[model samples]
Target: MKNKQWMSVLLGLTLGGFNFAAEAQTRPNIIFLMTDDQSIHSMGCYGNGDVQTPNLDRLATDGMIFDRHYATTAICMGSRATVMTGLLEYRSGTNFMHGHMQKSTWQKSYPVLLRQAGYRTAFAGKFGFDIQEVPGTKTLPVPSHDFDVWKGGEGQTSYSTKKNESMKEYADEYPHCTLSYGAFGRDFIKESAQTGQPFCLSISFKAPHLPRNADNRFNKLYKDKIFTKPDNFGRENGLHFAKQSHKTRGYNAFEDRDYDKDYNRVIAQYYRQVYGVDVAVGMIRDALKEAGIDQNTVILYTSDNGYFCGAHGFGLKALPYEEASRVPMIIYDPRHSNSGKGLRSATLTGNVDIAPTLLDLAGCSIPEGLDGRSMLSVYEKPTATIHESLPLINVWGVSASHALTVVTKDHKYINWSYAGENYEVTEELYDLNRDSLELVNMAQHPEAKETLKKMQKLYDGHVAHWGQQAVDYNSYQQFGMLFDRTKTWAEKEPFVVELDRASHQSVK
Candidate 1:
């Protein structure tokens, strides 16, 4: 482990994706594909018995499957910010009701840094958040100018290809936005290949999201098919969860109303949308091969955040639970020696690690003040560990469900500070190794006393770091006081966000 750490640092200083090159390293083309509201359960590689995702499964087989990867901030807007900036949500200062990501932060993002360092960079599909010159100012602009090819849309991009402004060209052919994004990647790869330049392409797919408008081509594909429910599927499994965690749409699955009424049918429709992404994944890989850059191109697939899919009796996401924050992550670097080794890494990783890893593959220096470290070392050796701990945050939505949680490779600790008339300051501890479904809460168990104390110390360290590094503007500075476990509910209640940023909205 010590040797791996030393060598990874050496590679960070010197080599690109190709491992330990004594001379100059060949920079590989990077393609990052991310989906909306995808869970680890959606893929066949993750041991789902019902779903059919051959392309994603093949990518995992061709390279490595990350079993413990997570989105540090488990929401679309917030997680996307963390993925791009290599920073935590508080430091990035980006979310729906949170604030805008500073232009300076966007400048340090992987695409910007890679382009500056002589790599062609392209971005398409849901751009997620707009950039401002500062955190608090209202002057926001789409960062299309930052990338070489910008086919990105703002604000939860439409699933219909014709609806998205930059993607209308493909609507006549693809119709659906999921396949249009794939075509964009194919075109970019073909163009970049002809230029003989290493390129970084990111395609964020708006598939498998809510409101159930999956591609018609894939409609009824999963019809009459009953999906397998996770072990922690019903309300009985969620009784031990904190009461504060169940105040919003996140708890809708337990009510058996609307989308949650028919778990089999609704879950099947979600899988059908994921099936659209699977076909798109196949398209990108086929294009790479046709362009003859397949051997030198690296591909990574993950999600902004995970869907609940009725896990822990929760229908939607944004909770600090396994099915919500623990997303699907796969990295295939064909230029590296470790490629095609059929590896599964249990090392803990997070959304912030994506930028650093991509920059490292491009042979660009990672900027300072980043909370993420490159996961290429873990990619090289499946047993290696890059991140020992990461914070899972949810400061959006109703205040009752907003909480701060910390997770390690083996255990997780969550703190819900919204204590009042109906809720108390709650704590949850789970030995994730033994209870991957989060079916058991060891917070107050007698045998978990020693483990709980160690996790509490880790939790404290995160809170301290949040205090020191959280953005001072846009009400983010208050979460530090709000998340403090030692602070009383009365003392910290005033620190919460003041505005009701769509608290009345049905979905977060």
Candidate 2:
């Protein structure tokens, strides 16, 4: 009887060990999704009230949503570098929005680190850094990227008809699809999940971007809704840096546009592009579930930066305004100890935290080169905030000037340099709580003098850290990118306005 009882106990122990090994073999896969220039307020989850982002909203319902998240920089390359490297734009020195990436400086990006860790990694969609025209470009792969599978780069400004200039050499084996960016993303997710190996896949969406175009289906999604312009629309820039930045972008949200026609179409099209991206997210989530790994994959959805979208009378990105810098950052870790349903955290977060967060979650060593702290501890201890406050800085990308913005929990300060130097000569400051639209400037106000001084110190500290010694806070204004007649648009070749005295002469 004793021998029989011992035999039964040993068999039960053996079965339990087998089950544990199987569970251990199931390492979590990561599906990282990022959109270009999408505003946080544009999504339903973020309370846009109009934009239909059902997929992302669902993800929020299932996982955790981070409010008050920010992008380290408001440009494509800068933002991407921060997220991938877990470093600030200043730390990585890839602050420029579009340019060649120095491989030596940015080799420590998370994807490369994941590759080193034996995770099959793939990256797809708009690779925006190498922005200049290529020479008979057969493919658009960045010369420095270490992504094992790279299928990316929409060649033109328009998202709808982005001509596929070339496929990356590594992506040659995969069947290339030229459908809308959404469809391409959905297909990539479907294929990657079938690999049956633990993998890290990044789906970068390039939509709701300028020359904005959407698939025909989404074009009609919100065609009938009466879209309202931003509440802070047409806010004035009391700061010189902001004013010049506004002038450079031609901040005429409602002026040049024919309200009778273009306004509704633009809004509708923008939402459609957003909806298509949402649909892609849903497809990816569904694919994970269909592959029976939905409960094990860590899904993250966010944007590189926010778009002005008619806010502050501007349409494009690269500004220090909240509308341009605040992006949507959401992380859905299935194995997370935090709330599994509809969890919301207001702890300050940004692209800089992405790499460290993922690395910590993966049980990988966080590299010392990064500037961001892993949120793993934040997730465990919600009481402790990451930073007392964070500073935001925006230098010129194509031009030589500075637009510096400082964001606190309740206040925001901006100093614009039109000459790209001399701060005291020109600047703007606003109390966001009192003036959400920022129509009034409190910089020169006597009562706000102390606040301005403190903000100045913060801005100075960031500038020094970033190696922007040329910024003359006293007189910070200069022409960064000069217009050239050789770069004429095909649509504008017919008209010429030559300056004659104080007037213009029309060239016939």
Candidate 3:
């Protein structure tokens, strides 16, 4: 199987006629640490005074911090798919709630690319996406034989190793899953160092996600703390879709219990889980240092998607709001002496850029047909703009809550489609420069009509460029029960493609 995989990789390289054999030897080791459902507001480095993230703050101090990073799709599976394949969720065909990542797409992912380039690759912690399991269909195991080391679990893995009955060997000294994953990471780092090969380790932690469980050691950290609600915590000034969600989704943080009690308890537990992830980060960093490769290794820390801690009266993610889409990203390269340490870059970047950036840094030939460009230049030129605008999509199956949002540095425009019909749309416009909290929707404002037109044109262009052929929404509707709220995915209409860019000119 390994030989066959290598043959396919060689064939691909030969067909493309690109080689990086010479540059591969000097490439720096890569460590990508990702947390589940962690927002920038939850991190100390990003100026959240309530949460304690000493390790992540130190990581930012050692490297560059990206202030305007976002996820193309603000959901776990879709965002993870984007980071892995460098493609939009619609293009990758992995946008559904439950399905395996197609093998062809998986082959082009960073792990496979780095492994084929003579770098040892390892993946630990939660492998976010799940494989489709039809009775007669063949499927690969959770961490599918692609890496030299694979210590991961499917779906939302347990917080405690004792609950994870299947994998005992990978368990750490403590029963916590974060520590267990960290143990795997440390072992892989040591192995890579002993072998004298450049390594790429991807750690995806399942912390601060749903069912927010924290270790007992951190139970007292925020027990007496009074968590403040977001300024837009209730239905006030929120979009209609968000307000409707609050009415229909009873399990959401806003609807589950008393707002004050639930918010404080959940927020505390969420912070505790984040603290656990921080401890894991410290462990991985110490392992890198102990292996004597800390300086040569590049450490990247980010999240799959941002979670709302009672922002806009929303508890979970999957919205195009800033709290749901904006994530924390840090790139630490110890060898970058040209710039001073601890630089903060406000360039607009997203999860899709991760694949291309890692491949570019490793001197590998990035594949064609990727939606994102390498952000390596942004690190060199902090003032440069990687993207003028970014598209945020939330089309999960046949969901009526689907939205298409176009975001620039200064503004955000959203077009919400009801029942998968493009014609039945509700628009929202926010000048981020003036209303950073998105308290005011300027879509109906007479003075903002021109801005709304420009944003719509941009959204139309993105749809034409990245949209896929019509998919059978009914076929995937069977998996709707796997999602959080049934109402969000109950609408069974097929997606409507936007008008052609050539025919639909911008409204000047």
lDDT of 1 by residue, 1-508 (tens): 6998788777656545423232123788899999999989989999997999999999999999999999998889899999999999999988877677888888888888988776778989887887888754665678888888899988888988999999999999999888898888889999888876688899999988876888888876888886667888878888999999888777975565344468877888888899999999999999999999899899999999998887777877888999999999999999878888778999999999999999888878889879999999998788998877999999887787779999999999999988866888899999998988888899999999998999989989999999999987766778888888888888866544353443333123
Q: Give the least accurate 10-residue stretch of model 3, judged by summed lDDT.
A: 499-508
Highest lDDT among the candidates is held by which one? 1
Give model 3's TM-score versus the native structure: 0.84
Query: lDDT for every model?
Result: 0.86, 0.62, 0.74
* RMSD each, Å: 6.2, 10.0, 8.2
Q: Residue 48 lDDT in model 3?
A: 80
Q: Model 1, residue 464: what's the lDDT? A: 96
Please give, for residues 93-198, the per-residue lDDT of candidate 3 as tens digits.
Answer: 5654434566667788899998888787888777877533431145567755888887777767788786665446755576778777777788888888887668
Among all candidates shown, the one with the greatest TM-score: 1
1-508 in candidate 2: lDDT tens per residue? Answer: 6996676666548755223223224667787888888887679998888788888898887777877677868877778767887766555544442233345544677888776665667777766554213311232347335776666653323343334443433233322222344454455556656655467787677776765657665555886778876676553432333436645553544356432236667777777877877876776777777767777788888899887776666666777777788888778877777746687777766778888877776667998756687766666655447755565656433233345566765567765533433212246677867775567777889999998888777666655544442221111211111111122233222221111111111111
TM-score of each: 0.92, 0.76, 0.84
Query: Candidate 2: lDDT over CA atoms?
Result: 0.62
Q: Give candidate 2's error at residue 208 in angstroms.
A: 1.3
Compare candidates 1 and 2 on TM-score and give the better one.
1
